[model samples]
Target: MRRVLFAARSAVALHRLLDVVPVFAGDARIARCFTLVPGSDFGVDALAVVDALGGRVVPWEEACAGAYDLVVSASPKGELALLSGPHVLLPHGAGFSKTIRAEGSADSASGLDPVYLRRAPIALHAMAHPDQVARLRAAGTGAASRARVVGDPTLDRLLASRPLRDRYRAALGTGSRRLLVLTSTWGPESLLHRRPDLPAELAAELPYDEYQLALVVHPNEHSRLGAYDLAERLAPAFDAGLVLAAPREEWAAVLVAADALVTDHGSTALYFAGSAADDRPVVGVGSGGPELIPGSPMDELLRSVPVLGRGQEIRRALDAYRPGAARHAAEAAFAFPGRALERLRAELYGLLGLTPAAATSPRLLPSPAPARRMPAAFDVHAGLIPDGVRVARHPVGLAPAGHHLAVEYGAAGEQVTLSAGVLYRRPLPSGAGWTSGGWTRHALDSYPGCRTAGVVQPCGDGVLRFRGRELPYAVRIEARVEADGRVSAVDPAVAVSAAHVWVAGHRDWDGGRVVFNCLVGEREFRVRLREATEGEAGAAV
Candidate 1:
């Protein structure tokens, strides 16, 4: 039997370690003890959590000096770093869309230290899935070699709570009123911080009779921002009938009870998207841009949902919300599904190099699962179609195909060109669910154009380009078809060096609009495209 130290530093780490401790309860091969970091703000709360779980908490020095065989921690930093024996790294959560899964860097807010893992002797690095391991390896994180797909215990809790949705809703007294819970993680760029008045604005606008609003902020908000500050900030929204949920409440309960979710870039969104508790609409506020890791289930959800770059879009999205492919994509990300606890227990015992005692329990350890294929390459789904471009009548490609546009750069300048034809995808069949659409090619001239708006500078008849010294250039084009049947002139698409980009348009009969919003780069540059009222075609060339 090995003596294990569960090191707690942050609130998130404590919550995660607690999930594992119970599964190994009364086991003979491992003896577990909890220890808190000296100055963690959540130490008192963590102690309460441990006491409730009937776990032992030893003093930090005593635990460290006890010569423990293994140290298991949510983070590799702090005491885990100081421990002499091999340690198992248990990161706080899954859903890597917001965090960088690469080797050297860690999610700044996640309390993990990949550098610590790189520095320490890691006996095992247990992740939610093999794809996660692959990403860490590609990022050059040294611990990838010791990584295993053990699944997440919290996910199991959420999955098991699925059938109790009604009970949780009743507890909230939410009767027939559609419940929408808004969650904002801690960060300056977090939605609540960015739009402090958002709840009041949403409450005042959304009909009180039909929908009830609730706010669940990250636990750090309570500690970092004092009660007076929180009360003062949230008072107006509370007065407007917004139910403020306690930060310590089980997130699974909230997810089970709520009909819809609104959040920014955080793990809460990932948890909701990845669970089967509900397939209701989840609207993400702010930043209608790419995720840190593109094409995961959560990433797919963000792309599919109407990510409101502006607050006004929130109401519009909710009015027309529906659960689509993102829900299924998210649900599929869980490798062990409802069996996380059992699977994780197996991984823990494997890490300790021991077999479980048969007399202890029949389900003590789960049989090893077959390796799952790594999730890769996000599908080209609906809702990402650009504004104001119509699919050509005789578009050549499959319903949902992808094409790469070429962008060539040189000391002279940069040139951008779209593929020669309109690569289009047809509407998915009714029962097809959320399968990836196949894209096919046709002539670029086949699609019709619409009236163009927004800032622009004219180039030739229908072309625009940007050339900035050492900066990646970006251009947005909106065009309206003129009476002469010519595609309204703003930008002609062509390919150049260094990078490849593409433009694909589909006919959206429902909205009577054309869409084109696909450009790959960190920064966007809008050309000063307005031509002088009367001049020799002078522009910001």
Candidate 2:
């Protein structure tokens, strides 16, 4: 028997590998260890999953020292330096949603790292779609020659078990009610993190008497907000009659029961697009602006399906959603449905120089339905600006990590107003002074409380006014934004010299944008600013 180790760095990683591990466990010719990478953070979901997998845990150092015959990882990060065996890279999720990585950087999961592509000796890369292989090759990942399409084993299992939808619906006590599933992936750019009122807004717009709403949040969000804490934060929506599914429940079953889906751009949307049996309407909620991968599955879905803006009403979006185009796109994206697990098993076994065991009995994998109406669990990474206004100084186009001026704000029952402008930084002639670096472009969001690409609102003489709206009491300007330039936070002078923003009329800096944080009765408001010298003003590139 050959020894194989499945190493993971986070709970999200474990979810990705869940489809493959069980098949390996059923085999007699393979010895497997499902363990964590030493020194990596483990979310509550990951811990719960690890416990359920018979606690086959080992430290990264210990596993590498064990002389495992082969090692399988989501990415080549962590203590991979300790491993001496042949390696395989099975991505934890699908899509090229993240920003492009530097040639040799191991900072992201897209697997475009130069070392992994060029010299780290990756033996095989099992991809979810053939398009991914082309994408990898385009990105110059070293393993193009070794890439193979194995479909997605998770989707395979879920699609094959479509009958479970009835059970899931029953378990949720949603008899005869059309279930609307809302999924938001974790990150500052995620829908709920920026627009905390999305659930309430959506639920309110969707007739409660006609349809039932269920929310499926990302595990990273649960880790950022403790499971219980996240659940508490979303309690208002739950109380308003939204069904919060349990984290441990198979997302497949939840999707199975959904009559329609409203989601952001993430793995959840990718999988849902492929596995929805009824070919139901998939309503995409755009980040306040256009930030989707053009021609990718997400873009395809948006083009074919009905898409709503960040703060748009649900009923209106749904009325325009068409299901035919989505079905066609799904067929193209996931070609070998229902055979993914079998294909994955064959490929991995071949890589290990062993014959896979004979096929098991013909029956759906055992996926139990979760209990009815669980509390919502929210998650987001820390250091994210939460429901507030933030200001950070950097070169005209650079954002320094961990250096932000953020303030949380809320109103009870009144509307808040916001507007903002930028001051560019540039070097002056003859060493006399540094002034404006380039044209001042003011940023605008289509909606008030979500992270979307900043729409460049043309301005005159370094002044621009964003359209304002009166929102419900709990709104905030929580978008992922920054100035464009490189400058260190440690150097106060350099930071001060960088381009920045102010709330138009106020002397105080209010970020690239400004917000009026108040309820109908409150007199108080907040703004974020970074000090700058007089010479830095009117700096045009």
Candidate 3:
């Protein structure tokens, strides 16, 4: 059996390897193994990815000693010269759009820099675009002779996952709301670094029901700073209702789910432009001003896309995404659109002198819901409209307190929120439901300010009980969002939230009936919250 060594130096590299590993399924002739290498300071974090992938890891020393037929690494970093094999170096990112300072050279296009390129006996340089090779050749990099256009497997997977956009959104807990993603690459020039407060600000600024906000931080950042530290830095955003993408498997999925993107000149903005969000709203800030390679794909992306200036109203700039915006530049950065796996598999088999089999098919990556912690408390704005109530929620700790407050049962009880108007829990077991009244009584008893308490039943509907002489009202939610004349479904929280507002101020008593406007998933129905008739006791009319 021919041995293959997958050298991983960073999370980015490991993700690239993951893109192609499925191509070798059921190949009994090849034994695949992985070795974590060093390039960035975050090389140690690659071990976590290795563990997560169940990548059969050989120690660096053991990997160096072994003779392999083909060695693949997304980066040519960390002692590639010592590994005995026809080394294939793939660009972990969208081509060579970054600027790197190597030993001796001041700054060069990252992957093409001759100082790093010619240092190893690299058998192949996997170019995403033909222009990468041109840049490499122009720089007089002797290794350019071995460069080949194998396309971008990362982009291929992203593009392929476009059909699953709705599924991606559903996994992330996004119902009918438009998903707004804030993406950043690592380093000082990243969007998060420059505008650390943006997540909280935007989360506060947007109505929770109308829009869903998510943060996609680079894995390298999570690596550079430990998980705890990263968590500390983003805790405010979390408290303010910003859904954070998990370290792996989520960033790309978020991109796939994004309806609008707010980003720096990082690769994500470029990826968003090329992928599902090709025509979606993309609001950019030029943190890469004079930093990125001028006229490069990354630069062209920032140039072509609209720039959101400092102190500019963020909402208005959302429409800044022009039609066919950055699509050309993104296309230029990637050569073959959806065939990276095919071209790459052929290239690897050729290097091993083995005929590549076409039986194995590449699978589109599944985007599981990111295990995110939703805010425990929300500052609500419940406005009485004509025969209905429009409720918007912003997680607490973001902006100043408004009129109404809602608290979940599991939250650490707040002294100031001891008098909260709305107290609720969702999907509670049938025994502990509002009708059963153990936890609800305790919750209302603990908070004297709360006049009503509620709990969502397993059926996605809820029951709200009043403190005084009122029967428990059954809560039902309907999603009324439509696209192409087709309505969408909403999360249970939407109906529960609006119901919280109704009881928060006893709006149902003053008004005849209220239509709870919210989403349930993707289907549309205008839900009515009405008082129970004498014939139908405790039933919401």
Whose TM-score is greatest here? Answer: 3
Q: Write the per-residue lDDT of candidate 2 for residues 239-306, one digit (tens) a residue.
A: 54577655544566777778888887765776777777666777877642333446666556656777
Candidate 2, which segments miss by more than 4 Å at Cα? 39-45, 100-109, 113-119, 288-292, 310-312, 360-370, 373-541
Query: CA lDDT of 306 in candidate 3?
Result: 73
Q: What TM-score should be assigned to candidate 2?
A: 0.64
Q: What does candidate 3's lDDT look like per residue over 271-293, in tens digits?
A: 77777644787777765754477
Those runs of model 1 whose alpha carbons end farther than 4 Å from true positions after fitting are 28-30, 38-44, 51-54, 99-114, 226-229, 288-298, 309-313, 328-333, 357-541
* C-alpha lDDT score of every prediction, in listed order: 0.52, 0.54, 0.72
Angstrom error of the Cα, residue 294, model 2: value is 3.4
Against the hidden reference, what TM-scores do the models get? Answer: 0.60, 0.64, 0.88
lDDT of 1 by residue, 410-496 (tens): 111111123221121212234222111101101122222211111112332222111111112233243434466643322222111
